[model samples]
Target: MEHSGFLRRWGTLSSFFLVLLLAWGRLYAQTPSTHWSDEDRISSQVIKLRNGITLNYAVQGDPNGPVIVMLHGAGDSWHSFARVLPLLPANYCVYAITLRGHGLSDHPARGYSRADFAGDILEFLDQLHIQHATLVGHSLGSFVAQKVAEQDTGHLDRLVLVGSGPGTHKAGSSEDEVTSPFAKLTDPIPYTFARDFQASTIYHPVPAWFFEMMVGEAQRVPAATWHGLGASISAGDPLEDLKKIKVPTLLLWGEKDSIFHREDQEVLLKNISHASLKAYPETGHALHWERPERFTSDLLAFIHSNGPNP
Candidate 1:
């Protein structure tokens, strides 16, 4: 009887181990092997908008192919998409921009509102003579993209919003309160604070190099810019304005995202006329960082699809 019991327990343990191995294999297959060397093929450039703001950006792939304009989140530069860019096909013309008051972009004393950022993007399209392009934005950049789409510049072909919310100002939310952490930030942001902030956005493991790169990027932003951007994000509710967006929209959110809840995505879907949502399982706010390979696949599929806008 003792021998029989031991055999039964061993069989169960083996089965459990097998299940875990398979699950890990699936996750490993979906992650990109991104390295700092992957950025070597990308070229950096700067363009001065008509408003006299010089924006730094990185470009890759064929210039004549379908255009993709990527806007990074607050305190992030074009490097935010470093992993995704290398995984993209050679047929795409990707431009990842560093928004004003961040990265190497010009930092004005003011004008950090979403509308101001949208104006810069429109002017950028005009200057580059890009007739049509897909606009991709993450977090704060998503709000800016929405503002751009509202203007109906006739240049946006599609829209992709990652880690986005309907709006940043929830009446009783701790982050929106006047005494929020962002409100207390001062110049020369501490390395630990920046590291912790970046760490809080991801649930899965990323390359240590990539995480440190992101932390460095966060520290580059001035406290005043952070204050301005934070205020702009909370200043208005874009729920009604989202109705003005006529292009096909895709929202990619992480299931584990604490910053923006699932309800926020539902609110976005209800407001945007032709928007759809794809939630990533076990992922956090920085889904792309955690699952770059999967993110690229989904983005390409959306771009190639000709389904009727619903």
Candidate 2:
């Protein structure tokens, strides 16, 4: 009886070990391959900078095609361009970056200035060994894009500024729509704060899922980001910078955008000699979010219309 009992116990242990081994094998098989394309990859990458700060970003589309970099506004992540990523031409390689202090990127206590952000972008490109490429920036990202173009025009081919223009905002002024919406943002910011800000500012009605997604992204941002980025905008003067942008420029605005009014676009149009304005009717501050299909199509058309020579 003792011998029989020992045999049963040993058999059970052997079976358990075999099951675990099989499971491990399955998991190993399911792991992503090192040769995966950028389009198939997600923005889970962390890049360490010379300053010891880390930035996060994702890439999509053909690896050899013309590069088009997308930079999101404040309080956003690389996911901001998720909707337009797959819609881009297959012949183009797209890069979406989540600036430091936002998204999965490291949140340093300082270095959130617009110029700092632009420097980070330049370094990002340098690290990747990317030469001239088109730049598309939205809102606050537009400010950073313009800064990069002004500082080094050779790094960019064509520039697209969405919901942005010369910074006419008075420093520390609360009368401006964009600054006013986020003026009261406090540390450990709540999801509700982001929801309320988006609801009050976005001209078109965004779906519930989009609102939730945006709020989720905003909630990840640290309190320092809000204060630091805000101070950067307050201290920045982009009017002169816009005038110096020599690249072919496209300015996209929404007719109903409350944050950036018609007057702002007018000033932008007048200041940038090579810039052209395309206003979307019945749209809001988030024009791309309001009509992503149209936004993607227009972007492709513009980029291809004046694409660099092959």
Candidate 3:
């Protein structure tokens, strides 16, 4: 293909969105991630940050066991990992985090970038007195987790990234949409052109109930907050920072992920040494939610094989 033809071919509107999502961290992806409930066999609490921010959190399994922090995607609460919680061994303790502005966490007026989110996680860990643990992040959470690891490499033992976006400096908009509250945020919450672009995402049989639940949850977010938070998620580049990570890592992407294309995964594997990649066939953006059994089982097997991070 000629240069212009190739550019046009690769320059689909959705393709640029794929780049934005890979770069910006937050995109409310909460499906089952409503507020923590008692019937779910989970315990909930609030982690208070020194800055007067209170982040809502939940825990499942033995509290005294080795720590495993769970981070949700953008627009989602910690409960997004609800199904995966039961699959863990009793010896492992898990804490699910709600991003500052989403879920029940306190949303400040400013400080909405991935770096801010990473700092929030650090504060959460500090409050819990959790000295060390492995970190697992999904989508937007993956961005924050990646950023968090950069802040304190010593704090993360093993890192697991699920359906993580790539590192792009651009936010992928043809015109300046940040003119207003609604314009600043990504439409599908993940991509600016998600309604049309999501076809390129993951490939699971999207159930009606899940879609409805996600849609409803997202609709509740105030337009201004959502857009402002969305703007914050896409403000910077984390690709250069990715090279700073030396910890053992596992990178997983749904084979059908339209949000993060194959090229994005290739970039990750190429850049991160000691990183392994797995593509879940028939799965889309929400790999864990779409195939809980397979995702959790694969996660368990990988962690067991690697043993605890030293």
Candidate 4:
């Protein structure tokens, strides 16, 4: 009887542990990996431009290394590059900026135009004494970078435009009837709208943590800024300005990009003197989010390559 009781006790203990182990395994599977949550690798800072607008930015890599300034898309902050920042080499100093009226940047009553945005960037470079640096911009930021390059190419080493088009709206679109969904947005933008908007940008899967972070970033912008930016984007085309960008330029696009089409890339190439395009297969508008490793590799190759520009 004693031996039988001991056997029963042992079986009960083993069963309890098995249940516990399975529960622990389920918990671990549900939790996001720490690899994607490594925000400690980068440092955040805020700068007040001479125009009195304060902009927030994230910095990473060597301070004394080659300079590279990144501009995020509409309604996004420097955290948009969270995945890409950690992957960059230590030899390059990167400044990923959150544009005015977005992220933690000061949102004034006006000044949402591309020209206004470009002006702030120029002043930012001057304040930091960045005489020459490569500029990387995505979507709305790409247009702003074009303006910056147009206004002054002497301060720039190279230009990279990701998910950009010749213009935000089709030619001849009136400002009042702009084709942007942001124009109709009201204060306290719906969470569903923000989530769906972000979801539409990526064809590939991203970490749940990162996707939620992006949606949160988009929700931070106010309605007035959205209306102002939407109107500004619809009011102008930067094709003429592209002719003025004399620096080596790289246009990064995704094959399945719903925003900018192949024709837009052709127009960009035709205008810029030294420009090349690299299209990612099965990627979408947010190529960086979809394939950050490939994006970083292509960016680094373009920066270091001595190959002739097409």
Candidate 5:
């Protein structure tokens, strides 16, 4: 009787969730995030790189304050940063870059290394003639942020690595993903790029439409880009370079992150000098998206309290 009752309850809940997903697909149907936005009310720049790669970036808030350069992770465009932009305190200029092949940016044949992305950022800053900026990176973006700091850019203020490590961490490839429906219990993929960041969390009063938007985003990227980039970021260990980074660094992790586990966090903390560590409970890799208010509050407090930008 107990087993039977449990099965019945599980079935009922599953059915309910299915309906929610379908409703989101129909009711909140949104076009591909890649759709261009004109009149965004934000300063926009199109940078053509030295290697024939073109990237798109958007700036918001006070243009005069210390600059903040944000980098998104794999399979995500600048839209991933869309949530935190408006929440930023006024007078802080924030620039979000859409990586090649992700959003409006052109997909180049190669040159997807961390250095490649950092080079683009360096060029972008030089073009604008900005001297210094705070670097905020999420996931793969975190890795890029470290590189920028290492370059001795003379303008790098500090580094905030969200849901990422100071160096290479244990993540897997698409082939390593366990896709069985029951396998949902074991998340082999980082929630950020999967577009399932919402479902991977234990967010209370979970907004019904957030996960649905992720599904829409996954559909926008071709299967090749999805699998290729995931493989790329997970392919090697990049943490040995962490010691080279001299800027003040903040390392954040999701409590429930399956990809970059606590072990990964500790290892990163050990390598990077006195890197401050913070973890969100019951949250997966995309805590920022899953819990925006709490995430921003914690982020801003840390930023303001840190001794005058390193």
Candidate 6:
């Protein structure tokens, strides 16, 4: 009887392992290879900082053209701009940086603060010998961009902050707000959960393949990243930082963005002297993903505008 029970337990465990393997294989098969051919898909390399930390970044378009550095939000990688890349003119050089502790970058045990992330951007520009460039940031990235512009006004040509607000911290009680939607992901997050989370957040329908590719890239981010960086943002007061944005700034938000609402935009407009806003109807936090064409057009127009002859 003991020998029979042992055999039964082993057989059940083996069946479970086999089922998991098959499910993984099926999901992998569904994911496409188009990510490799994406116009924004430049092979990434590491930029070593003075402190020995390394940031992974992708560069595309003409080297001599106007530089535009894009920063992605928390729980996301630089691939957030994949669809927007091909839409821009070929003459514009675009650099996308994966913040430390996120994406393929080194994950240090510390240094997930907004100031730390902002400092990385400045150092990254210095290492690349880019004296100044138009800074574009989305969500958490937008908050970082504000800090960069404030660090030195002369180093910024223009600023674009999307799906961002005046304050860095969450509006409610700290204890209850510390959790993230991605808290459930395991160390090596399963692609299915990532896909479901991506689909659930957006108010509009996106192409299935696109969402798959996005979640695949996002899943590569370490689980610690979400908590570390999130805690940093939610613990600070950022109204002072918002006031420091002196460059001509463009604030873009989606009508259906649940994270940062219209009230947040109003607060930002009140704080920043040179800021203006435009809203995308029927869009959510993933405005760039939902309305790529409009995002590209509006961004280009803002970048090209002389802004009252300076």
Score every model by TM-score: 0.85, 0.82, 0.76, 0.86, 0.73, 0.81
- Return the lDDT, model 2, position 162: 93
Instruction: Put down candidate 3 lDDT per residue, 1-310, tens digits, no spaces.
Output: 5998878877886698887886663443443343333226677889789878899888877778878898987556876776678767667788888888777888666677788788989888877778557789997789888888777746667788998755564545311232223455543454333332223333675556555455454444444556665566556465777887777788888877756767778888877777898888878888987888888877776676677632
Per residue, candidate 6 scores C-alpha lDDT tens digits across 38-149 of 5434657788988788998888878887888999877677778777887777787889898888778888867888888988988888878784578899987988888898
Preferred candidate (lDDT higher): 2 or 3: 2
Q: Give candidate 4 misplaced runs (Cα > 4 Å).
A: 1-38, 171-179, 306-310
- What ranges in model 6 sit over 4 Å off? 1-43, 170-186, 190-193, 307-310
Q: Identify the superior model by TM-score, candidate 1 or candidate 5.
A: 1
lDDT of 6 at 229: 62
- Ten residues in a row with the worst lDDT in model 6? 173-182
Which candidate comes out best when scored by TM-score? 4
| Prediction 6 global C-alpha lDDT | 0.78
TM-score of 5: 0.73
lDDT of 4 by residue, 1-310 (tens): 9999999999999999999999998887766433434456678899999899999998877788888899998878998888888788777889999999999999898999899999999999999988568899998899989899888847788899999887646754432232368878998978987898788788988998899999999899888888888788777764676788899999999988877789889999999989999999999989998999999999989988833321
lDDT score for residue 25 of model 2: 84
Per-candidate RMSD vs. true structure? 10.2, 7.5, 17.9, 4.1, 12.5, 10.8
- The list of candidate 3 runs beyond 4 A from truth reads 1-40, 170-202, 206-210
Give residue 229's lDDT in candidate 4 (0 to 100). Answer: 86
Model 1 scores a TM of 0.85
Q: lDDT tens digits, residues 1-310, model 1?
A: 9999999999999999999999998887666544445566689999999889999999998888888899988778888998799999878899999999899999887898898999998899899988568899998888888888889668888999999988647766634642256667997988987888888888988888789999999899888888888788668664788899999999999999868888889999999988999999999888888999999989888888833221
lDDT of 2 by residue, 50-153 (tens): 77778888886677888889899888888777667766776777788899999988898888888889888988888887766889999888898988888874
User: TM-score of the candidate numbered 6?
Assistant: 0.81
User: Mind giving the per-residue lDDT tens digits that candidate 5 earns over 250-269?
Assistant: 87788777656787788778
What overall lDDT goes with each candidate model?
0.85, 0.79, 0.70, 0.85, 0.67, 0.78
* Reference-based lDDT, residue 128, model 3: 79
Candidate 3 matches the true fold with a TM-score of 0.76
